[model samples]
Target: MRTPLDSPFSPGSDTVPQVWAGRTAQLSDWRDVVRPRRLAGLPERGRTILGEAGLGKSSLVRKIAADAARRGDWVTPQLRIPSGTDPLKRVAVALLDVARQAHLATSREKRIGTLLDRVEAVAAAGVSLTLREQQGPEPYSTLTELLVEIGRAAIRRGDVMVLIHIDEVQNIASEDALSQLLVALGDALTHEEDVEVPGGMLIARTLPLAVYLTGLPEFADMAGARKGATFARRFRTTTLGPLGDDDLASALQPFLVEGWEISDDREGATRVFMEPEARAAIVDLSRGEPFLFQLAGEQAWYAGTGDVITRDQVIRGWGGVRSEAAAHVERILARLPSREREFLEEMAGLEPADRTLTTIARKMGLRRGSDAGPTSQRLDSVRGIITRGKPYAFRHRAVEAYLTTYWPDPPAGDAERESTSAEGIG
Candidate 1:
C-alpha cells in the first residue's frame, strides 16, 4: 500500500507526526502535573511555551491535549483566540465547548445548558459582564461566574477537572481582557467561598482548572510591555529550541523505516529506499531544525523515481528545498524593520562560526560601545532570526543563505572592504 511518491514528511500543518521525536520528557512532566488528584499543592501558575514559529510549539500543545483527553480525567478543548475576536467572548465559547463535552447528570446538564443559552444571548446583544450569577433572563454577570459554574458542574459529576489550551495568545489584543481571563483562572484554582441562593441557602465551590499557552518568544516581551509585570508573572515559561544532531538523527530514523522497503538479505535486512549516505544528507540538510527536516525529506521523496532514494536524489532535491526555504526566509525577513534587516545583512558577510557582537559593531561602523547592546537586543527580539550570545550565529542556515543571496552590494566605504576578508554565506 506504500508508493515511492508518498512522503512521510508533512510541512506547514502543526499536527503531530506519526513518530513524534524528542519531546517525551516535557510531555511526561505536564501529564503528571495535570492529573486530577495530583493538582493539589501544585502552584496555579500558567504554563507558557515559548519558541520560534516552526519549532513545534503548536504540535506540542496538540500532543498534550491528546494525552489529557485520552486519560478521561480532564476535558481538554484545543482552543486559540481567533484574530479580531473578542477574547472574553471566545473564552466563554471555549468554556461552553468543554461544558458540552463534560459527563453530567440530566439535572446538571439542563442547568448548565440554560447558563450557556443566557451567555450566548448576552454576546449576541454585544456586551460583556463581570463575574457574577444572574437571575432569570439576565446575563451570567461575569466570566468569573460562568467559569465557576462550569467548574462546579465538572466537580459535581465527580472529581473531574478542566484543562484549557490557547495558542497564539498574543492575539488576545486587550490587556484588560487578558487580565480578566487571568483572574478567572486564578480564582478557579484557589477560590473557596460560600455564595447565597434565592431560597436562603448557601453553596460553595472550588474548581480544578489548568491552563496552557503557546506562542513565539517575542510574545514574552509583548506580554511584559502590553500587560505589565503582574501579567507577566502569572505564567511559568518554558522555551523550545532546535534539536541537537543526535536527536535529529533519532527523529529521522522512523521516517526512513516507514518510507523505505527493507530487503531480507542481511541479518537485519537491507534498506531499499535510504542509503547511509542519503540518510546523512537528509540529516545534514535539516541542520537540526524540525520544519526543515520535513521539508528536505519531502522534497527528496518527490524527486526520486523508484523505491530507492540515493545520494544523487538528495542532491537533486536540494534545488527544490532551497527554493522553498528561500521563499519562507524572505517572508520572515520582509517583516523585519529596515535596521534589523541591515543588521542581518552585515552579519551574513562574516564567517557564521566566528561572528560575535563586537565584530558586528565594528563592521557596522558603530561609534560607541553602548550602541552594540541595544542593537543586539533589538535583533534578538525578532524570533528565529539571530540568537543573542557571544560568537552568535543565525538560528537557521536558510536565513543566512537568503540574506547572502539577496542583499545589495556593500556601500563603497570602509565597511565594504573590511567585510570582504571572510567568506559570505551561500
Candidate 2:
C-alpha cells in the first residue's frame, strides 16, 4: 500500500475535515432553530458561535452551511468580516450573490425577478456609494428587501431558507454597522409578515432569513460592548471550548484507520494507524485543542515509515509539533503589549504545576498590590493562549513547553526558574 499519504484531517486551511466528530448536538440544535419555518412562539434569533482560536468555529459554521445547501433548503453564501472593511457594503455584495444563486436555482416564473433586478441595479452602482449619497433605498434597506422577497419566493415554492454564514464577525470595527445589521434582519422578518402578492399569491408568514456569525470570545465581548445588552441579546450565543478526550479520539480515529491503513502480521491487513502508546502521547500533546490535533497528526504521519506508527515516532514528531505551535505562540505574543508579555514570561518560570496567580504574584516580588488580575486578563485577551482558571496554565501543553525556552535565569535563592538562559522567540 502507498504511504496512505493523502491526509483526511483538515487543518481547515484549505478543506474541511472529512470526518467531523463532536459538535453533533450543536449542529442539530442550531439546524432546528434556523430551519425553514419559524416554530410556534419561537422567535428567529441570530446564532453566534463563540470560541478561542483553533477551536473550529469557522469549520462548524461551514459544516452547517454545507448541510443546509445539500438539502436544497437554504442558499448559504459564506462571508468574512475582515478588519477595517465596510461590512454594509460587503453584506450588500454578498446578498447580491445570494440573489444570483436564487435566480439560477428557481424557474423563471416563480423566481423573485423584481428583487433580483433591483439587486443588480444597486450592485452595478458600485460599492463606493457614500452614506449621504445613497440614503433612500440604502444598502441596508436593499438587502432587507431582497431577503424578504427571497423568503416570499421560498414560501411559495416549498419551505426553503436563506442563511448567511459570516465568519470573523469580530473584525467588524463599526458597532453602528453591527447594530444596523441586526435591524436589517429584523426589518426583513417584519416586511415578510404583511406581504400580499398582487395575483392573490400567498407567501410564508415567517421570513426564512437567518444569520450565523462566529468569532473569538474577545470579539463577541466587543460586539456586546459596542451594542448594548439588548442588541446583543438578539443573538443566541454558543461558546465552544476544546474537545474532550473521547471526542478528540473519535476525531482522530478516521484519519488513522482510513487515511493511513497499516498491514498487521497477525491480522493480515488491519486498519490501525497508531500504536496505543503513540495515540496516548499524541492526545496528551494535543491537550484537547482541535488545531493542535491536526498539527501533531500531520507531523506524526510523515515521521514514520511502513505500516504502524510507533510510540518512538510520535515522540520524535512532537519535537516538530512543538516548533510549529511555538510559531503560533510567537505571533500571538508579538501582538501583546510588552507588559502582558513580561507577565507571561514571569508566569512561565514557575513549575508548570505551580502557576496560579497567587504563586505568580509572589514570584514577581509584589508586596501589597499585584498586576495578576489585569495582566492575566490581558493575556487571555489573545484568546486560548493562556487558560485563566484556578491554577493558570497555557491552554496547550506545547505552548507551556515552548515558553520554557524563554524563562529568565533564577536568582541564587529563587525557586521559580527552571530553564537555561536563552534568547526566547521574542
How high a TM-score does candidate 2 get?
0.75
* Clash count per candidate: 3, 0
TM-score of each: 0.75, 0.75
**Residue 161, candidate 2: alpha-carbon lDDT:** 70
Error of 1 at 48 (Å): 1.8
Worst 10 residues of 2 by lDDT: 416-425
lDDT of 2 by residue, 1-426 (tens): 214354445553624566455887678776765673352213577788876667778888888888778878565567877897766666767776776666633546543565555556555542344344565466556667778766665655555677788788878776667666666766765453644557988554666666788886666567666665765656777777666667877766754566455455455654546677667766766666677777666666666554566555555555655666656556656666666677778889887788888777766666522556777775564355577776787764444645785311112322212112112211
